[model samples]
Target chain A: MVNWQLYLLMFLPLAFVIVFNYVPMYGLLMAFQNFDPILGIWHSQWVGFQNFQQWFHNYQFWPLIKNTIALQLFGLVVGFPVPIILAIMLHEVANDKIRRFMQTVLYAPYFISTVVIVGMLFIFVDPQTGLVNHLIVSLGGKPIFFMASPRWFRPLYVFSGVWQGAGFGTILYLAALTGVSPDLLDAALIDGASRMRRIWHISLPTIRPIVIIMLIWSIGDIMAVGPDKAYLMQTPLNLSASQIIPTYVYETGLLNAQYSFGAVVGLFNSVINSVLLIIVNFIAKRLTETSIF
Target chain B: MEWIRKLPKRSTKGDMVFDIVNLGLLLIVCLIVLYPLYFVLIASFSDPTQVNLGHVWLWTRHFTLEGYKVLFATGSIWRGFVNSLLYCALSVAISVPLTIMAAYPLSRKDFVGRHVITVILTVTLLFSGGLIPTYMLVRSLGMVNTIWALILPGAVGAWNIIVARTFFQTSIPNELLEAAKMDGCSDIRFLIQIVIPLSKPMIAVMTLWVVVGQWNSYFPAMIYLNNTSLYPLQLVLYQILVQNQSSIGITSSPESMAAQQHLAELIQYTAIIVSTIPLLVLYPFLQKYFVKGVTVGSLKG
Candidate 1:
């Protein structure tokens, strides 16, 4: 039976996805043509692969790609696992009151606006008199130019990401943790297994599927970092290190009016990200018997 | 709470020791996460020089309200604040209903095309057009610099839609629908008259998720809004704390210009407090519903 309710339900979200998500995809052609407002998309000069070639041959192309992948990989290395570790730690804690309180404090940062997170970074790291520098000096170490230094940018960005995200990310893993049968934990304990062994042998294996699903999702997002936080952090001193693909796109396309070039770069990024996601999903399914699809 | 009530409470000596040690470590982690926020609050009220000197810790030193005074003195800041709230409100209004209608049917195992729709939504979750194409579409739609541009483009988050779908699928039993059908209810009627009333908690959680998303989003506003009037509060704060870099503030210290290169740093911290306060004020009351509702919705799925 074609449930009338089902058809109505399907049409609404589907209509939304079509109008908003899929329709925008047609705009990708602007990257190929010399898009002009008067000429319109259909009538614009189709420049073939010129836009992609321009992006490829640009002096800063490789550097931007390098920075984007580096920062994302750095984020993945630090950001992905902190939540899992935190969730395990949180699950083991018997005190509900304290655990809840800790959760609230940690999750609180996630709610703070990104502009504010970037802002707080400046407040805490002024090399002259910033709180972080003051502490370092007091501890008999030289103050670091955190925001300005190329060396420190990735670490600062990644650790701050962990601080904001680890708490909220715990909710997913914690949800998966709830599925770990208490009977298994008890049985392991009855067999004189240590707490660490019980966690390693039983709890870890049970939550493995959820972790794999989330890992696939994270790998898919590797190229999609927005330009805001990194752009905000950019100064003459740190532009070399801080500039990434998104910032480059914004500067070249929107700010400089190199619209075709920007679109080409964006399309390139999308292709790479999609390829990465598919490859990661294939490897995950092969290795772990789990996949996002 | 149900799970806690069911848990066995008796503990061994090692368990007691481990619990104490674990509590201490967790407390320290909590403090490490929260202290920077605490310092920002204190420094926002403190005199600029003392703040710059790093003299204040745990409490305000040479306290003043200059940052707030400067922040409020700008007519632009107030406009941005109102715009942010407007964006959040309109987004919630559109998103909540569409999500409810969409999620409820997908939750039904008998629904044709459910799996297909699920795959389509899941694809969007993993891969997108990467911003520029999306922006071009918005511009093409003539939504740029308009408030609807912000509200409409992101109305249905695929992840949230799926989550809501899972919530409905897991929470609402088919037997209940059968009972409602036996009582001679139509599809929309059963949805309006029974399902919505039963789905209050999931609705509330999704509301929080959507509202928080719209409220904190500044990048889209920066991209789509050329009009300063359309700029959200976070974007205005971004300009203040970032673009100027404290070099041109009215409060520039001749006595401390070299040392005060970081003057805008205070405003950045102050901005965090400003941007976060509205959501934080509402969070405690919603916290119970958020976890309880999401857990129930997710656990069953």
Candidate 2:
């Protein structure tokens, strides 16, 4: 017999998803309509692909795509492996007390607000007056404008992200690593395998599935370069380097009130992210025999 | 013979060297993580001129609580802090119970629509309507610029639901639930009496995750909140950190030049430190739970 209580309990979460997530997808038609509040979606004029073209032809359009893709690629290239290495290192830590302490400290930055992290960066990189510059000058080196310089922005963003996030990211792999049989490790040890060899030959292969799943998930979120961190960092000083698709969308839609154009740009970004995720998932499934699906 | 030859002597010099190098690298990683936080704390106490000159690092050269004095002087900062606390508390209260209930049914393999429910939730994690649609929905609900916009829109994240459900399925045995059912315990009764008691670690972990997510959150506050008064601590602190010069409101002062200069260097760093401290204080108590929660959540279903 079907339980009525189950239905009652499920109501709130189900209702919330439908109301908030599914319903607003109707708003995506705002990209097509000259979406007026008074007329609403059904009555608004269908300009079709005009809004999408507006984003495509904008002077800054290619740069936005370039910046967004480059940053995502940079994050994946530099950041994708650190957590795996960290998980391995953490797994090797003989003492639970120090391992736990290190994990706690490593994750401290992840809990810090993004704005705060960027702020800490600003302090760290202050040219003549920054701590980094002071250290450089004290040791006889030139001060550099780390935030203002275009070249440094991506590295700073990606590295700081790794430092902040790698620990938290390792949690999953470590969990998977725990499922590896101790007997297997003992066998490897008896065969004269060093810790590094055991990790490479045994520990790694076991956790490979979890790693691929996470990588796929991360790639799916690639286009979602957070607007807050990028936006907050984009002073006139760093504007050229920091300008990306999300910020462009925000400026076009919210700041300049080009709602249609902004929606089109955002929709385009989402489409690109979705396509990349699918492609990567296909590749991963082919290569590793693992998929998010 | 090959295995015996391949085996290195225990506690060899090469192994000791590798261990030392590894330990050193780990220490450096810890220092890199820790120093930014330490520097900010010290700089907030140090003289602004000294801080600007990069004199403050490990300790404040001129220790004063002046930055805190100035930070707390503004009524707006305190108001934002309270709003943030209220928002986090309310969201946790709503989210924790909702998640438990939603997760409980899904955890049961015998639940009629378990796979369907799981697929429905997981799909959202992989794809969403993106920001604009979500915002439009919030606006349509008349929740824009309200605390409800913050809480109700994100009551149940798909990732968290999966995590909670995984915790339940793995940790809570079906035998226990069946026994409870045999004793004539209803679903709600079993949830309250059996599931909750056994699920304390997961609950603690989930609460910590949700609470941290809420507290450190700035983006939703930035978008949904039109009223400056409704702005959370992170948003206000973000404003301070972003527009380093503008935050001080330094007009018509006898010491205008010095105050302006001091305000620039100290405020950003100080604001960051202030924003981070509250959550860090709560971390040690919750760290074990967080690790456990993350571990459980990350395991593939």
Candidate 3:
């Protein structure tokens, strides 16, 4: 109630954010320095854009960028619509109990840890013993080593991601759909409008702002493909296709202790993300007249 | 069945087609989502050799408890499980309270600088200091390899704060605050006695989000803590899954080696089940809250 009491309440959490989040922005300066942990951030020698230049010239740069963008586009194409589709189909289900049952079943996977999902991938795709390969071998087909092969990398990563995330995404869309006023749908039904026609005309229109916001949100994070799963899935065999910017940053900075180079790569990754968010938000606002900002 | 028959006889042919197609598509989706989990459960019970040989399908063949025996025999699994439990419980305790504190003040209309603070917090979501620097900062804090490292850096999330704040603002009306203030009740007392009781649903939802998140978390553990004893279940599972050859510690006795390999395969399935069972058990009870979780406090899109 009082200003001082309010200030006290806000203190620690604000301090936590400032220290954990903003202080790291200060650490971004390490990208421009030949950062030595021994020398510390302040004492480290500044190298300006040299690390950035080296990264740009590196052979892995193009592949890393290409792989990252490709994965995002792939996800946007396939993963984005999946929940929308799920929500719509679930909406169409006339039986309430059946709709709820299917949703509960689907939401189960969303809570499965990313590590577990990849672990599931391992068991399902093991060349000699996995289920898919086993099925293939039984059907008189060659067993493909899905994990070890470079070509299968993106497909495995993206599809497994969709499998894990689509159910969770359906929640918000379903919320939006269920929140839609029934009067509109009832009017359409009385007019002899077919289910498909009503959905196309009413349901889709009602959720378009949400769809745009979600789309823009996903686009804004295009540069932030967490290296966790890809890093987990990475092996020498699949390195060519699986190597993306985040993993590269992890390896260069932490594994190899190339802190400056890692920082350079990280800064580059973040800059691209910020720029993309701005551009996408601008485009979304122009087209949809609704933006998160 | 009766409900279907009760529908009007004039129901369109297109609607029939739509129902059939929709049901069919939904069934496929359910199968795709469910079969892998089903396979894991069945495989965990089956003989490791049967599983490794690709002989088990549709049902458990050579059913055995050998995988569970081996997994329980491993000391690291128990240690990791305990460590994970501690991390999860403590982190939620720390985080939920902090999120409430941060959220409450921001929810207040009279709180000066709320806009600036929100913008600063929101900007952190869009751009962060990148992983390396953040890691460096953690290391400098002398938190590397400490439980504090796991708990401190992410004690509260800004998004959670926003959600909680939204809940507080909408649900705890300004008039209630005014009435409490008129009675000379201190802000802390009012919050503790009134705001918290009314905000239980939001708190519960946020707790579910944080608990599940903390339970499943391994990345920070992977980076910050190197001690084997400190490893959470997921990190330990990561070892068993990704780099199992070492984690299994293959011995050189040929007979023992052959048996260990067979056991190792089934143990893999057991590890996944054992680690995830707590979450799976909690899911049914918490699921209703998750719906409330997504819908509430989220400024309706």
Candidate 4:
């Protein structure tokens, strides 16, 4: 007998998917049309490729693309390896009490909301009345308007991201390291191999698969950097460095009511991300025989 | 044999050097993470003028609770807290059951069309319809200004379903289901009695994950709910903290503008602590489950 009971169980979730997920996919057709809220998706006039063309030719196009890619790439290069190193360091701490205490402290920041993190950034980096500027002044340097300066935006954004995320990111690597056989490590130690050599040969290779997987996933998400923290961190002065694609979509689509153009930009981002993911997955499978797929 | 296995290995000079270096580096890492959080706490309790003058470092100087007083005097923060709690509760209620319902079926080997359904769900992980279209869909559904907009649209995620499915597949054996079937027990009964009760740890992990996510989420609330009364904590936080809007309704005069600026800086510190304190408090107790959740999800199906 066919498992009708299973189908019954799947009913609500499938319905939710169809309505929330699938309908939005269908509404992506609005990227083609001159989507008017009054006329709705079905009745809107379809101007094939005009919206996309407008986004392509828009004054903000190159800058938006540049800022988005730069921020993500910067984040990936700096933020990716910290966790691996942290996990390895954490793994080496034979004292469980000290290791656990350190892990708890490090992981605490990850739980703080993005808004609070950004707020803390603004408070800490404020030139007139901030601790960082105080330190700068005491050192006989001028107080830099870190938030307003476009040069500092990417570093602040990426580093704060690293600060909040690196600890939590280590968990997977730590788990992988924990799986490394202790007997093998003891054998290596008895063989008079140094701690560094043992870690290099044993702990690092054990976690290599996870590291590659994380690398591939993060690469696939290059264009999909979340706009929440960046939006919070954006100032009028730092717009050059922080005006990324998702934030642009929010500004145009929701705030300004230019639905079609926003849809086109968003659609473009989604397409590029999907394409990148597929290509990266293919390359990873070829090189390491490990892929998200 | 057990004592021997537990005995410490011989530590050569090189090993001792490595241990010292590793511990020293970790201690620095811990300090870097701890200092900012500590600064925020001390600054919140310090006098704004002293804080502005950078005298509040290491501990409170010219200590006062003026920031907390101003913060508590504002009604928006309280309202936001309430709304956030309600949203989180509702979201956890809806999402956990939906995840379990969907995952249990997919985990079963004999379930028809599981592969097709799995592919459909997994596609969303790789490709989404992007923000505008999703927003349009929500608006069209008349959920724009409603609580449903926050709780419903993003409730069941592909990653969550995959995690739940993997848990069910690994933890719930087919033999138990067969035994339950032979006992003439219905599928629903088995799920309620056997699957759910056995999966309490996973459920708790899922619930905690959903609660944390829903509590921290401001984007959906920012976009969907235009009504100020409905604003969640994070959105309210964004306004007061980032936008620098004084919800305290202190009308600024030229003289008070300087005072206003001081209070604003102090309020920012207090607000960060107030908003994040709940998560930080529960974090120590919940850390183990959170770790478990990540490890469970990271396991390949």
Please give the DockQ score of every candidate, comma-separated. Answer: 0.47, 0.48, 0.70, 0.63
Native-referenced DockQ of model 3: 0.70
Best by DockQ: 3
Instruction: Give the TM-scores of the predictions, in the order they appear.
Output: 0.90, 0.92, 0.97, 0.97
Write one digit per residue (lDDT tens) for candidate 1, span B1-301: 3322223444345655555666677778788888888888898888767877778987998777767765665667778789888888888899998887788788887787788888888778556665666777788789999988888888876767777777777778889989988898777788888888988888888888888888887788888888987888878888876674432344545756653444455555566677789897788678777876555544433
lDDT of 2 by residue, B165-239 (tens): 888888888899779788888887888888899999988888887888888888888888999889888888777
TM-score of predicted structure 3: 0.97
How many residue-pair clashes does candidate 4 contain?
0
Q: Against the correct fold, how does model 1 do in TM-score?
A: 0.90
Candidate 3 stretches with Cα past 4 Å from truth are B3-10, B246-250, B297-301
- How far does residue B278 in candidate 2 sit from its true spot (Å)? 1.9
Cα displacement (Å) at residue B299, model 2: 2.0
Please give, for residues A97-198, the per-residue lDDT of candidate 4 as tens digits.
778888999999988999889988988899998889999999999999999999999999999999999998999999999899989988987888888999
- Docking class for model 3 is medium
lDDT for each residue of candidate 3 in B1-301, tens digit (9 for 90 to 100)? 4432234445587877778888889999999999889889999999877887887778999889888988888988899999888988898889999999999989998889899989988888778899999999999999999998888888878888988887887789899999999999887788899999998888888888888888888888898888998998889889888776425655889998887777767788999999878887788777787788787644332
lDDT of candidate 3 at residue A89, scale 0 to 100: 88
Model 1 lDDT per residue over A1-293, tens place? 64787677667767888778776577778888997755667888899999988888989888888899999999998899988988888888766776787788777887877777877787688798788999999999999989889888899888888888888788878778878898987777677665566678987898897787677768777986888788878877887779998888887877787777788888788788778888887887787775655
- Give the candidates in order of DockQ, highest first: 3, 4, 2, 1
Model 1 residue runs over 4 Å out of place are A9-12, A284-290, B1-17, B245-268, B292-301
lDDT by residue for model 3 (A69-143), tens: 998888888899999999998887878778888888888888888888898899889999888998899899999
The CA lDDT of each predicted structure is 0.78, 0.78, 0.86, 0.88
Sliding window of 10 residues with minimal summed lDDT for model 4 chain A: A284-293
Candidate 3 TM-score for chain A:
0.96
DockQ, candidate no. 4: 0.63
